[model samples]
Every structure is written in C-alpha cells, then in structure tokens.
Target: MEFKWSVPLIILVLVNCDLYSTIGGSTLKNCYLCNTYEPSEPESRSYSSESSELVGILVLKIVHLTLNPNQPSQATAAKIRSCCGGPVSDHFQSDQFEKMFSNRSSLEVEDHEIENKGFLDYQSFITASAFYQPYGFGTTYINQDFFGTKEVAAFLAHVATKISCGNKVVTREQLSRDLCYNKEMNSDLSYCDEHYKNTYPCAPGVAYYDRGALPIYWNYNYGEAGKDLKVDLLNHPEYIEQNATLAFQVAIWRWMTPIKEHQPSAHEVFIGTWTPTKSDNLAKRVSGFGATMNVLYGDLICGHGDNESMKNIISHYLYYLDLMGIDREEAGPHEVLSCAKQVAFNPSISSSP
Candidate 1:
C-alpha cells in the first residue's frame, strides 16, 4: 500500500513556515494542500502575493520530497543487498505456508472457530514481506552458510503465536488451531494512555484493542504505526483487521521497528545486527531469539523464570522452524531461546511501544 508523508515532517514544514512568516512577511492562509483545495473560501485565498508565492514554493518542495526521497549511494545499496540475502518467496513456498496453518485454514477441523477463515493467506504475507525485504526483514545473512530463513521462521512464529487461538497445551491438535482470530476477543478496553494525550490522543469512540497478525495495542502504538504505515490507524484501527496484507505489513513493521530509541528491534536482536551493551549483558539480554523476546515483551515475558507465556511463544517458534524444514537445534541452546533471566528493556510502568 502507498503511504503518505509522515505527519511530523509536514508539521515541521508548517512550523518553519509559520516562524518565517511571523518574522518578516504575511502568514499563509489556512488551506488544504494535500486534500481538497478550497479555491472559493476567502480565507484560503486571502494571503498576500509574496506569502502566496512562498506557500506555493513550500508546497512544491513538500510534494517533491514526498515523491522523490533521497536514494542511497550505489555502494551503500550494494552493501545492503549483500547483507539482506535473497527474496523470502524464493526460500519459502506457498504450499509450505498453507501446510504450516492447515488446521486453521481447513474447514474440516472439528472445533475450529476462526473469526476470519481463509483471510490470512500466503500471498498476503508475501506481499507484506516484500515491502520490508529491502530493509532485511527476512533476508539478513548471519554468515556465508546461514541466510535469513531462520529469521523468517522466527518472525512468523511470533505472528502465529499472537494471532493463533490455540491453547497453551503443546499438542498437534492444539497447534492446528493456529491463526484462529484476527483480533483480540471480547476486549472492551480502548487502551488509550493518558500520557500521550497531546501526542497521540484517543479518537472519540475508537478502540485501540489488540489486532493484526502480531496484535498491536494502545493509542500510542496505533498512532505510531499509523504514522509509519500511513494508514490513519488512530481513527480507523479496524483497517488492520479488514486488510490481510496490511495486517501482515503492520506485524512485520512491528518486528522491524524498535519500540524505543537506542533499543534493539526484534529483527536486530534476532539476526545479531545489534550488539549488546554492558547494561544488556548485565541484564542477561544476549542477541538471539531470547533477546528478540526481551526486545518485544521486556519483563512481561522475560526475567520471570520460565513463564508459560514465554514458553508458549518459544514453542511456536520451534514448531514453525520444524514446519519450515529448519532444525530446531539451529535456534541455539535453551539460554539463547529462552529469556527467563533478561531484564525488561522498557518496563510496563513506562509507555510501551
């Protein structure tokens, strides 16, 4: 999906323009440049000729920036390509994907209660993944022998675990219940944090409950994701549930993005892109699948001494690795797979990303 320019960038431009006009010239009139232009409104056309020219120049610059972002140098692009491995679709086939979620997608399952049956498909996942492939979503190479297949498995494992309706029991039958729900069930909570009232205010009557493949929650998360994805999720968070590709896209985005500045993203942690600091080492937050969990869940799942929630997520990862024909041993030792000793990167008391 096409994304509009970020709100912050636009706001910065407007603020700069306002400052410039206040200092020397007549200010621009309130006019919508991106949306429908009001030529008939007196306020829209009331700006001085000099201000009008300035506004016109600013608008052109904004449009140009939006359409023609600066491209990386050839050397940088080549280096990125070398590290990103190959296309995910080339490594992961559609049939294998369908097989991985056969019970969830099949009508024959005895107790299947999928909210959106057959909605989550391989094509949608591939399409969503394609958008992030350039950024090394599932294509980061760890070494000459090992490519990004393991990272792909790790990401999908999180997606499967979040969206799945399967119980905590690790059985073949229970595993079949994966991908059963598109959104959180029976949630009345709007998940609007008062802390971000000015930055990401809760929309009137809109609920930012858990939704999408990886299930993002809260107004700040929705607002941030909306800004990154350019989807207006603050007002219409339901768009995630409505669009399968978008849902996967949002999930992948969550995986690729860091919750806080100076913190490692799940992708970075999983693929060894992020080096652990002395603090992280003291916290027992090493780089691996365990660190990925630490990055995503913090103390909720980590540093809890083998919690069921943490184990369940790990089980899903192993299960997906097996389904994808990768050895479970590649996931590393128990310490690398489990985050039972890692401290929270960002505690729950603070605003969660």
Candidate 2:
C-alpha cells in the first residue's frame, strides 16, 4: 500500500523577459529538493521500541503527510531524504557538549525530587542526537554546512536557559556561572486543558507541566508529542527527566516543528526559510534568531523592552557560541538577537507581565 503525505506546494513561475529590458528583479529558480538517498544499515543503531515507533511518525511530521506505522516505506524514506538536501555535517562534538553542560552535575538535586534522573551526560546526548538524524532535523537549516553549528548552539542555549537552576542569582557575574540549572522546578497547577480532553485527555495521575530541555506543557502538547514521538508521554510525563536521549529528542522535535498551523518552524525562522509578509514586516518579524524566540515564547518574552527572560536565553546562545569557538560577533545585530521590538507571531492577551 502506498502512503500519501502532504508536502508544501512548490511554486514554479516561468516568465519570458525581453533581452534588452531590466525592469523588475529576475525570478531566480530557488532549488529546494535534493537527490534522494537510502539509510544504510539503519539496524546498526539500537533504538528502543518507543524510539523506533518515532521514525514513522517523525517521517509523517516532516513530510506533512500520512503513512502506515507498521510497514517500512522506501518511497517515504526517499521523499524525506530529498527534503534533507545533502549529507548532514558532523558539526557537533562530544567535548563541546560537555563544556556546554559542565555545570549540570553540580545542580541541586533536591532530596524530595522524585523525578531527578541525574545530570544529562555528554555521551548520552551525543548518542541521542545521532539517533534523531533520520528525523530531518539534523540539517534543518536549508542544507547549509556550518549553519548547522549555529542552529545547534542556538538550540543548546535555549535548552540551558529553560532548565537552568540559576534562577536565584541576580548578578550577571554570578548568573553566568550559574549555568548548571537542569530539571524543571515548577510545582504549580497541572498544565492540562479540559477542552482538549477528547483528543488529549489528562492522564489519570499525570501533570502535563513544563519539563525537559524545551518543555512541552499541557495535555494537548503532550498528547501531540507522544503521538509524533511514539511515546506515551501523557501517562509517562516523568520519562523526560528519566531518559536523557528521549529528553534531547523531544527538545529537537520541538525546535524543528511548528507550534501552530500556517506558520514556519523555529528552525525555519532561524535558517531564513520563512519570509515575512507585509503585516509581519510591519510587526518587525524579520527572519532571524529573535523571530525564532517570538515564535516559541510569543508575548511572554517578546515585545517587552529589555525583558530579563528573553535576554537570559539570548545570553545563553551568545555564550554557547563563544564556547563553541564561533565568534559571538557573528550572531548579528541587536534587532535580530533581541525580540524587544518585534510583535509576537502568536501573541497572547496581556503582553505585560
């Protein structure tokens, strides 16, 4: 049986221009599709049942189409490889990962914290990253070479910021050293939504609160992620902290996918896959790192002048760039690094905190 998936419409416009005229900008054919390649010896990688299930679901998510979960589809694999462009560079290194999370081991492990799975080790994260290469997120930056390094650094910065245990420190000097914050510390209300109960009911004893590197809150989010990731995250919310590989995979998935429909993925925003419309231009939503924040955090972080939360995440990114031996100066202008002037692509009520 052939499984059909929905891919974005490729618009190819042809025009016949006069040889002597140079009126409007010429329509350059932007090449997007790539030559297809098959995964060699995929069985060599040991993925758990949950991780294995994710391959099919992830393919559907990347292709924006539907396919059978049980069968191996060469056709599907070929299409996915085409979207991936060229071979993904081994841009990240284990030592770089260790340096990034060097403080994780020292993070406070509360005696009463039942879900603490200890610090995420560099080897574990590196292994997990390798497992997810098939998800098409490995080279999400429009087939660029070293651009993957920037994306990875930017991604790790958000991961560090969200799970950082450095929230108590006030001084900048103290805060930079406070990078060892891991584990989600919130213990408030459960983030489940009753409206989505039919589709993503709150598991009997689970609280779908923020957890993991890039946390996924609410029953709907957990439900959606669980489906795409082939993990029962709704019922096993604790699985995030329990498994480093799963945690990293979940964060990468969040970074690569879109939060809503008709919008670009955070990866797309960072890699310049998205072009702003007139309204977006008016809102100052340019394609860059700041636009990525606006997409993920919305009004909670963006449009607020010099907000500390937004700055913290940005600081982490720049800091990671420096640590990764990439010039912090290459991060770009303040407008692209800070979302203080840009309107949220998905703004919520009460922009003011």
Candidate 3:
C-alpha cells in the first residue's frame, strides 16, 4: 500500500527548483521531500547543468508548505503553477470514483489501469457527489467526523484506495459530461423512473440528499436509513458522547473490512468511553442501528430492548456479529470482549432507553 509518488517529473522538477530559489541562490538546492536547503551542485549527477543550477542557485528562501505522502501536493507545485488559472493537477483515480456507483469490486485489472492515470480534481469529484468542494470528505474533517456513515466512508475509502493503488476512478471527459440523467436512452421507463426522472447530477444517476450527493446502494438493506439513524442519534447533545463513540466503531468495522480484515483488540481500548450519562438515555433506541445493519447484510437481524439491562446490549451487538460469521477471534478476543464489557457497564446505548 505504498503510494509511489506519481507526480510527473516535469512538475516535480519545476516546483522543486523554484520553491526555494531565494536564499539558496548560487550554492544550494531545496528538496521538497526534505524541506531543507542543500548545496546546489545538483543532488544527483543526472541533472543538466541548468537543472542543477536551478536546484542550487535559487533553492533557498522559497516559502514552503508542509509536504507529506498521502497529502495533496503543494498548491504552488510546478505543475499547478504552470497550469495557473487553468485546471490544477489532480493525483487521484477517476475511474474508481465512477465505479463506486456500481457494486463491482475495484480489484479488476481494468480498474487498476484506470486509477494509475493520475492527476485528479477532487473538488469536481466532490461536486459530482452533490457536495461543494469540501475541505475533505465526510463532514469535511480529517478524522472520524469525515466518515460517519457507511456510504460516505465507503466513498472516501474507495477514493483513497484507488489513489494509493495508482488507478483512475473517473476521467476528465466524464467530468465534463452531464453526470445525471441519460437523455439518449429514454425509450423505456417505470413510474418511479419517470416520476423522479431528473438526472442525478454529480454522482451520475443519483441526486443529492441534504447538501451531499446520494450514495449508491452497496451492501443493500439500510443504505440511507442506516446513515440517518446514526445522524439522528448523535445530534442530541446529551447522547453525543456515547453515540459518537459507537458510531466510530461501526464505521471502522464497515470501512476497514477488506483491508484490515478485522480490527485488533487495541481498537476497543482506544475507542471505549467512560460510562454514559443520564442524558445519554435520550438517544435513539439501538433498534434503528441494528435494523440498519441487518438490512445492509441481509442475513442478520437485530433486536433492541428498551431500558434493557446492560448485559443484553453487550450480547446484542455480539449476537449480530456472530450471525454475520464474524467472531471475537477475528477482531481479537481481547478487543471484542473489551467492547462487550463497556457495553455491559454503559447505561445508555442500550436496547431500552
């Protein structure tokens, strides 16, 4: 899962030289990777004298933004600067983003090649998803807030995976086309189709709900309902603390399944909260959450007890996990058991109020 830097050399070389041209003049070149000014003489012999001079002579004193792998490249990078006022360079997979609407696995060979095409416009992608270009995904936060629901989390995860694997999730041409309704294929139709015939704008065949683009149904079952359930529960200030904790666990389990297999025992320890407060009782019943999970998976059914003992709440989640053929061993007995223990002690987040 190493994301080899796919930025074009032309872009990198240009940005590297100008980014620190002031102070290092005539003596040093700056490395964006190192964020340090180094003697110019060309760090390597392959570079031409001019290239080397560019690297050394004017390499220092360039204002630099923090550069890191997995982060978007500096806005002032050479590629972007060259394209100035034009479209900026994107480094994400375009095809994969398109494929997210379909339930196909992104592991196919074609998908791989598509992702590697490189350079993406994340803002357009976000816009396509019915959201304004966000600071990032989810609720525009860097942490769990960005992945609160299964759909959004899945989309973000898919994009990241696509980028890491060097695949394109969408195409520049596709971005230009109207992504919503298909005007050419209007021969047949049903009531629901004709009723809501307005093409889904950015997400291709899906409309935005609230301010965000609609998510294609992936696992089936709860789709929007599951997301809504969590939203309703967490909105209450009293229930916010405990519900946030549980929501995060649910998201981690859903988002990391293909890669991590199952989270380790440490996850429970890292996420478990102190006992819930009396106000936490105001939260919605677990039935909605459970029912949502059951819908997504189909084979599993979840039941909630109102004002039930903490013991049953612990068993409740475990029961569904077991039904899904997931066991404590996969999640690690220690982690699963720890979560169960927390559930047992918590007064809120139970079946009953």
Candidate 4:
C-alpha cells in the first residue's frame, strides 16, 4: 500500500509543534529554537513579528518532512523502528480490515445464535496488535524489504478459522465470514488437566473450554497465558470473552511464544526463522506455513491426510492472502502449505503414566 500523510495529521502536527519539539528532540532541533526563543524585556516587545515568521518557516519544514515519504519525521521513524515488520498501519489499513470482517460484523450475521456475536471488531484487533508488534507479531522483515504482509495474513488466517462460524466450504467468500464467534459454543467440558495441577490449578467454578480469538483451551493454557499477560485467567477464564483487546492479545502471545522449551514458535516457523532439526525433518516438518500448524495444533489438525480441519485453515490463509492483495501463489506449493503428512511436535497422550 502507498504511504501518504493525511491533511488532518499534518495539521495536527502543525498545531502541536510544542509536543513535537519535545518528542522529536534532535529531529525537530530547530523547531524548539524557533518556537521557544525570547529576547530581553526591552527587545521582547520588538521580537513578536520575527518570532512569528521563524515559527512559520519551522511549520513549513515540518510539513515537508510529513509529506515526503523519503524523509520521515524522527517521531515517525521511532515508531517504525519499534516494530520488526514496521507499523501494521503502514501495510494493513482500516479499509482492508473492514473488508476482511465485514460479513462477520453485519446485522444478519449478528442475528445468528452464536456466543459473543458481533464481539470482534477492527479496533480491538488493531489495538491489541500494538503490544506485540515490537516482538514481530505482524512486522517481520527479511532484509531492507518488508516481508511481513504474508506473515500477518498467515496469522490472521489461523485466527479467522478458529473463530469463524461460516459453512465448511473452501471458497473465498465463505472464508471471508470470519470473526464470527469469540468463544466456543455449547461446550460443557471444563478442559482441566490434572498433570498441571501443581503448577496451574483450575479454579473451582471456572471452566476453561475455549476462549479468545484462537480459543485457548485447558487449564494449563489459561494459566500460562494469564501469567504472561498478568490477567489471572486461571481464576477468571471468562475474561477473554469480556475483553476484546485481551482476547486478541492472548492470541498474538500464543502465536509468538513457544509451547515448550527448546522449541520453535509458530511465528518462527511461519517466517522461516526456524531451522528443522533431524527429528523435525524425519517427521516431515519444514519451516513454512505448514510447520506453523505443526507447531501450534500438532496432530490434532495435522498428520491426518487432507483432513477437513486442516483444509479449512489453509483455505482461510490463502483467501486472506488474496484479500490483502497478496497473491495466493506466494504461499508456495501444496507441500509447503499442507501439514497432512507431518508428525506432531507434541503428540497427545494415548497412555497414562
């Protein structure tokens, strides 16, 4: 997407020159001199006109920096430097966000019997992203060039699939009906694991079925996410449903963090930062979108030979890539996008100890 400074934003900078001078520091060095200078008592009376002219010149300089993409203001550069992939606003704007989830937010969709209907919105997702952008939640650059658009699409694909309530179809329109549900429906299971009782005990009344954008299940999962986010989800797992920002934040945290020690995170696998070991290769796992599924869901939705669940996820990803103006072909061949034959990174327990 082309980056253009809006007139309102430019006018805001001009009006708040003092704020800019404080934050921009060396970048707006002369701005402070032009705006803050004062002469002795006798000369101060005569300095008004000259100071006003100097301030006008400073405004012109600031306007030039704002309008010229080649020369970003210091404040803008600082904001961009905070993210590994750069600011998401630069690549994914509000219009694209609306297009992606417009169906989910429609009145007809909201009328359906779904838990937390109409709960997921663009603002919540974008606001939550600010926290993890520094850790490359969406911003992942390969070189001087930005390569995070695909990565963002891949991550959102997972989110959309997990939370979607659309029909089980592989078409683009069907896949765009995402953000349908924030929490799992009609689930009575507590999903509490006894293994982590000592480390992460389940609360008496709370049931950790599935909640949040990616739907974190099990007591241990909630415990870990709560601890990291400092939200106390073990006691109040329902918090994920009540807060949209927290829901998306938990999802992004899961995407960026490794499930176990000495393991690759979903982010690492998808962005090609992870190298497959001898075991990973033997298990048919490679660093790509496929390995990301292996890293996150393991054998649950993988190693099942073209299963419906896995296919649905891949469809969402490819559809999102197209919607974001990224070619689906860039997602690679079927092998790089499928985890059908891959072994689970963390297999489910078949036999009790």
Candidate 5:
C-alpha cells in the first residue's frame, strides 16, 4: 500500500542525497529483485547511506530502476558521496585548464621555447592528467564531482605559483596566495644526499635542483618518484621540466604518496580520510585545505604565525575555487584554511625516506 512518512520528512530525505541516488536511474541495484546483480558490485565502492527511514527509499529505488535501465546506475551509486556538485564528466576540461594557467605561453617564453612546453596545450595536458585515478587521488575519501575539481585546482595552484615568472602578488586578491616552488631562485645547492648514494646514486652532472609540478628537490625524492612512475628521474630529473604530463604526474604522485610510511598523503588530508591524533590536535593539525599545505610543505608553510608564504598558497586555492565557480566559503574556517599555528607533520628535511 502506502508509506507512513510525512511529506516534509520525505522531502528532506530526497533532497539530502544526489538526485541520481534516489528516483533516477538504475542506481538501484538492490531493488533489482528479478535480476542477477551480483557481478556489478565494486569491491572498493563503499556505501554512504545511513538512512533512518527505509520504506519510502525502497519504493523510490524500484520505481526509478524500472523507469531508466541505462543511466550509468552502478557508477553513480558507487560515488554517492562524491564532491557533491558539478557533472563528473565535465569536472576538469581543457578550456577550464587554460583559464587556470593563462600565462603558460609567456611562462614558457621566459624559461625557454620548447615544443608543447608544460601545460600550454590542453589536449596533451588532459591525457596526462589521468595518472592520478589509479593512485586513489580523487576517489579516496569522498566521491563528489567537485572533489576532483578542487583537488586539481589546489594542486595546480601550487604548480602555478612555483613555475610563475610574473609578479607574486598581483592586484587580484585571489592571485596573492599561490603556493611557491620548492626551488629558491639563484640557489647553488645540488640537493644531493650522500646517504642514499648507494641505493639512489646521483647521476654525474645531473644536479637535482627542485623540478616537477610541485618540484621534488632531493636526490631521494627523485629516486623514489622514478621508481614509482617507472621513470628514471634521478638521472633524468630534467624530464619534469621538459614534459608537461610527466611534471603533472610527479606532482600528483607526491600528492598521493605519504611523506613517511605512517604519514597521510596530501590527498588524504584534503579529503578528510586523515583523522588527527592527539599529537596532531596538540599541533593543531586537522583535516581540510590547511592540512594539505602541512602535508606537502611541512615547516616550509606551516608552524610560523601568519606567514605570508602560507597565506599566498591559501589565496591561490581560494582564487582557483572562484575560477571553478565554487564558493571559497566551502573551505571551512580560518584554521582549516591556514596552518599557521599547526606543527609540521614532517620537517622538510628528514633522515628517513
């Protein structure tokens, strides 16, 4: 017969989930009573539902599945908790990419004119951007469409700041906060570690100054990234500066990999998978955009009170959010957006890998 829920309660439940999760497509496999739906199960896909009411939901799922059989049901259902808004297919496109790095051509001119120099052409850039999917970069914590977008933007903000040849703080307020390059200009340091020379020997004449999107500086970092990406970066650290895709890959790889075995990756920190320990709380490290800076930059960006460099990175993130048409308000409170008071998770230099 009929469900017992009141109209207002039903409305609340319906609005809470993505429309597709309710009376939309075949996102309702559990309601597939007459079919074999076992094989469609995603081993990694966990359910996000914890509804107090079930009767109305079941009816809605059945009605929706019966109505639309080919609406990418299983995929949508699996990502129920994704970044919440925007079309996933339209999340990060080439046009939007150009907007993020409009000065790519000029930046390249300042550096050197090479073919398809680092993120200038959208076609190659998009193709190479897929390296993060398998590493659990965008889909790890929450699966909102905007999650990927925001991650991309925040990451690119760091890249843009590091690679930028123009003024650091433009008149535009948002441009004021981009994360800078790991490489300090005019530094003669080779970043070669004698300790890892046996395991990851530095290539002769191949000085491992900071390179890549986020700029992996140390010989150890180059060796580790090379092993993970199947690229011999210790010897060929220039590959990052030469190829746009590889540069993005190195950065995304760093974001995905943790600083230490027990530490959380920048991705985890940004996506809320990282729960702060008592030490972390004492250090004021909580999950959000702010923790990402701590994860990536450590003492370089965090711990110092109201540091301009840290604020610059935060501004870049907010600018990118605005460019993506997302409200900067979603980034949470000031502490979560700035790690000024938090203790560094791992110091920039560590004895361990």
Candidate 6:
C-alpha cells in the first residue's frame, strides 16, 4: 500500500459549553479520538507527550526492523537524536552521553552503581536525543539493512499515520509543514521556536502536531511483534525472561527514583496528553504472551521440537490478554515465561527442577 505522506484529515467538532451546567455535562469540546480541546477538569488528568514521541520512535525502529532488525539496536535512538538532538548542561557535554556513560577505560562514572545502570542511563540519554533531533532538519540514516521484517515496515507506516494525526498529540506534522524541505539532504531549515529553544528544536514546517485521524488499522498491527518474536521464544527463552524482568525493574526504578518526580512529565514534554495510569495493566497483560512468543519464535528459528500442549496453553492465556486490548510491545518476558510454565510444565515451573 502506498501512503501519500501528506497532511492528515483532522476532525475537531467543537460545541459551546457553559461552565456552570451540572444537569448537562459541558459541551463536548473535541472528539475523543481527535483531542481538539481541554477536558472539563484538566488538573485531574495527566498526559504523556514523551510516550507519543516514543511511539513514533518505536515505529521507526519497527520499520528498521523490517529493513534490518539488527541495525535498529542503536539506530532507533540515533533517528530520534537526528530529529531532536540532545540535552545541554554546563557541567557536561550531553550530546555524547553514550560515550560519557559508556564502560570504558579510565572513566569515572557518577551514576555507575545503580541497578541496570547501563541500560537506564543509555535509555535516558537516547530518549533525550530523540526529543531533540527531529528539529535538527538533517537526514537521519540508519544502517543500510536496518529493517528486519515486512512487519516492521508496516509498523513505521502505521506510526507515520498516527503521528500525522493527533492520537497522542506529539505533533510532527507542523514540523514537516513549516521547515524548508530539502529532499536530497532530508533536512529541515528553520529557526527554532523561542519557547521550545531550551529543549525541543522548533522546526515549524517539519514538525508534527495533529495526531487525530490515525486509522484504527494501526492498532490492528500490534500482533506483528508477537508473530516475529518467535525466534527468541524457543532458543533464548531466558532472554525474553530477562527483557521482562528488566522492564519491570525499570518501571520500579522509575517509581522509586526521586529523579522521575523532578523531571518533566512525559506529557509536559512532548505529546501524549494523558497520564500513563495503565502501565501495570500493560505489565500484567503482556507477561504471558511475550515469553510464549519468545520461546516459540526461538524454536522456529532453531528447528526445535513441536509441543502442542505447550502451544495450546500459551495461546489460551495470550487470547485472554488479547480480549483485554493490550498490545504485544507492552508484554514483558517474565510474565510470558510464568504463563508458559503454568501450561507447559505440569508439576514444576521448569522443565526439570
């Protein structure tokens, strides 16, 4: 399918509302999907701009996965950096954070002792780069074979549509429109927005803003990761487990760390306008499926034995989570393993122990 990659169709239906009306709720300001106006009580609700932006980055990574999954390892973060840039600090050169926090010779790292310190620091810096690079107006290239599967390409197209619309309100459209488009260079040429100067680059034409008209089909493709994630399922099931535990640890760390409170809320920074209240919902829903998929995929890749009983049980639990409307990306590895063992193993959680 060929996407036009043009301006999106945004439907903002606004009806007048009186603040004092109790019998009738205030006139609906924006379509729920379009998000044209403020909710009646904005304070009670929180939004996550960073999440939406991250979604875009994820989409890009998915595309790279289709082109060459291996390239996405660091390319995903690099694209984000190209589009956004990096943080600035008088005490440190924030752009070179990867090297800064890297485990290298003769380096005295300040935050080295933290749990999964390497991953968290890397993620934090990469995320920062994603937030800043979009405004850079230069072509962000990934390794030539960055895409891994067709599913990944389709995902990027889906996210492109989503970002074009106002689903999460990260707004890449405005940047695209305002910037001077140089196709050969794949760069935007525009002065940064004064208000966003300290952090985000303001590439007016090149930036994206409205994420409303994103098709429902994008959500439909959430299963690709599961389908493709089979390689890890069979062979390196442990990795799936590790990925889940790590994600859980990251979530826990975010909750416990004082730094999270000090940093701008995801919504405050980028586009997703609602607070992420359902992370646990995601954690719970994806636990079983991710592990199962990883094991299955691994088996597929490694030419292993077929276990019908294990498959049936894993499918049953995965179907249960599907009914709840959680996506595969949200599925963690540990949950997947536990669910697999529940069905795959009769007495013990492990095959032998």
TM-score of each: 0.75, 0.70, 0.20, 0.74, 0.68, 0.16
> What would the per-residue lDDT of candidate 4 be over residues 75-124, giving only the tens digit for each residue?
66544422253345557876787777767766666346765656776656
RMSD of each predicted structure: 12.9, 11.9, 19.4, 12.7, 15.1, 24.7
* Worst 10 contiguous positions by lDDT, candidate 4: 27-36
Lowest lDDT sum, 10 consecutive residues, model 3, at 80-89
| TM-score winner between candidates 4 and 5 | 4
What lDDT does model 3 reach? 0.25
In model 2, how large is the Cα lDDT of residue 144? Answer: 35
Q: Which stretches of candidate 2 lie over 4 Å from their true place?
A: 1-89, 107-118, 131-145, 167-183, 186-188, 349-353
Q: What is candidate 6's lDDT per residue for 1-353, written digit by digit as tens?
A: 22222111100100011111111122111111110111121111122432322222232222211222132234354443212111211112333332322332112323232222222232432332222222210112222321112111121122222222112212222211110110112224332235534333333243221111111111111111112222222222223223422222222211111112222221111121213235424433222233223222222211122344333333333332333333544333544323332222112222110
Clashing pairs in model 1, backbone N/Cα/C closer than 3 A: 84-139
Give the 10-residue window scoring lowest on summed lDDT in candidate 2.
11-20
Expressed as tens digits, the lDDT of each residue in 279-346 for candidate 1 is 88888888889988888777777888998888888887788788889888999999899999888898
Residue 39 of model 6 has an lDDT of 17
lDDT of 2 by residue, 141-201 (tens): 3533335577778877777676665453354443344324234466677877799988888
Model 4 residue 348 CA deviation in Å: 3.8
Query: Which is the better candidate, 2 or 5, if ranked by TM-score?
Result: 2
What is each predicted model's overall lDDT from 0 to 1? 0.68, 0.59, 0.25, 0.68, 0.59, 0.23
Candidate 6 positional error at 221, Å: 28
Between the candidate structures 1 and 3, which one is better when assessed by lDDT? 1
Give the Cα-based TM-score of candidate 3 against the true structure.
0.20
Best by TM-score: 1
State the lDDT of candidate 3 residue by residue for 221-282, as single tens digits. 11222332233221221121222222222232232221112221111112221122453233
* Model 5 misplacement above 4 A: 1-89, 107-121, 139-146, 173-187, 347-353
For model 4 the TM-score comes to: 0.74
Top lDDT hit: 1
